[model samples]
Target: MSDPHATSPEDVDLSRFDAIVDVRPQAQTRPHLPESTFTPLERLLEDPAASLPSTSARVLVVCDIGMRSAIAARELAELGYQSVTSLDGGIDAWRRHGLPLAGTDSLTPNELERFDRQIKIPDIGSTGQSKLRSASVTVIGAGGLGSPVISYLAGAGIGTLRIVDPDVVELSNLQRQPIYALSDLGRPKVAAAADSVAATTTQTATEIVQGSFDSSSAADLIEGSTVVVDATDSFQARYDLSDATRKAEVPLVTGAVYRWEGQITTLVPNGACYRCIFPSPPESAARLDCALVGAVGPVVGTIGTLQATEVIRISAGLAPAYAGRLLMYDGAVGTFSSVSVQARPDCVCQRP
Candidate 1:
């Protein structure tokens, strides 16, 4: 018969324990069993009664492997505790049994393996990964800038990606928009972008809107989005997105590329919005189009990658890096620079 004071991880009825305590070091106690209280093995060894609940309580002790918890359980038993048990193989064995962990229960085994590298990061732990899986980001274009943004965000495991674009792919787009191919020519940009994202990862759901993003449709397009990305090539669309995001109180990652230069910035609600940098759209006559000035593929890619980074960071519960600042890249010179931005007192963002 098994020792009454020891139980296998697979056989333990967690609900029966009045107190489930983790006896590992504080740092090693992450991803522990649900509802478990932390009491390091060293502390329990120092003062068993002081480190635990009432001796009469039904307690379950756990550690990384079975060693620490077994020792802890023996100490508790020697102290005349009414009932106590140790997890046979500890948390490692429990994990091997495919049991649920406290902060990562929602993530599937595939997701844990897919995002393992990032999850190891102290700041972007399992909690941040969960946030990424719950976030929705709406990208307003699927061309040069939107291609990389959609691709990376999908790879990063964004839960939902809503793509809005009215244009169709063409031969000219292949020069910069790597998300599409010759076979995708004449296909709607949104549809093609969604296919690219689908090929990247199944974790993110894609929402395709085969329509232009204008003032009339901006709000409806961005509704329920955790973040918005402005990747359109027109000043008019930028102005509309700036106004719409500000009004909706959503964060916007806006970027632009012209020739060999590109600039990116993140606009958070109540912060310096796009309009704070450009109070109004420039005159049509003065505006330069990518078709006219010609865009460099890497230039747009650089900005798009940065925009994707901002969205992932924001979705993961981190502060926006470029909020109230403009980050500019000059590919021709291989240089980067930033300038501080402030909201205009009379700007629409500052109004009620």
Candidate 2:
């Protein structure tokens, strides 16, 4: 019942705690409790949906001298953690009580230990993780590009993922769409993708739209998204989603892959819209889908992964890579390149 943030060192007790979290910067924490875990304040702030112990568990947050730990505990309380507190004097107070110090590390004990590496990245840290937890992203398609995009986004803990695809999983899709299994062949792509995302992380809420994405349904499917990703193979769907997002002043991350080649770009409200680059749709005779063109698995993966990265970056308040540029990936030669894009004066996207 004691407030860890307010308890004095003389009255401190560790046995009452279910877990002790050290939130100090790793550099400043040379000696920490042997049993305590280290997760910096920024990391905790970034990961809005961190999978901590059960709400019933007693968690005591600690920092170098208690300032940040108190802040973190308050944040956890606001997030509805049932029992949370901060160490008053932090590690310094613990040492004063002659407690054994542990190494500098902070992560909850969970099966998803694989995320430790990325959680330590300065830019993404815990804060970025939290942002991903709060973000809602809608990916249009569950095919090759959608496969990687969905996998990465789901794995990264995107709070809500809306998958829209009218097609069903097919035998031919196994080569690149790793999110589906042989048994999923007859299932709708959105259903299969939802199952895949659920299996990846329970933190992400998967929304399925088992039909085509178009102007008619765009508002319902994508209007609330923090970012829209175009992974659909058809140009019509891409243009539809792009136009809808453009009108809503939302950002869209889109990519395309064809025969060992792929391209990625971000269409922001104020920047050049997708139509600015094309002016008009390609002729029916010239239009090509993967069915007619053929593409390698890695090509789609590369572009899809890039699209996912852009979504993550944008959600985390970081600069998007292809806002006014097109990133081209040549899988045959294993090279990546980019070209600047400008808003067409005559295009509707140029209007205020």
Q: What is the C-alpha lDDT of each candidate?
A: 0.87, 0.79
Strongest candidate by lDDT: 1
Name the weakest run of 10 consecutive residues (lDDT summed) in model 2.
Answer: 103-112
- Residues 76-114, candidate 1, lDDT per residue (tens digit)? 788788788999988779988988789674788799889
Rate residue 57 of model 1 by lDDT.
90
Runs in model 1 lying further than 4 Å from the true structure: 1-30, 37-93, 282-288
On a 0 to 100 scale, what is the lDDT of residue 132 in model 2? 74
Every model's TM-score: 0.78, 0.70
Q: With candidate 2 superimposed using the best TM-score fit, by how many Å does residue 233's alpha carbon deviate from the native? A: 0.9
Candidate 2 lDDT over 111-140, as tens digits, reads 124454555555665556667778999999
RMSD of each: 4.9, 11.4
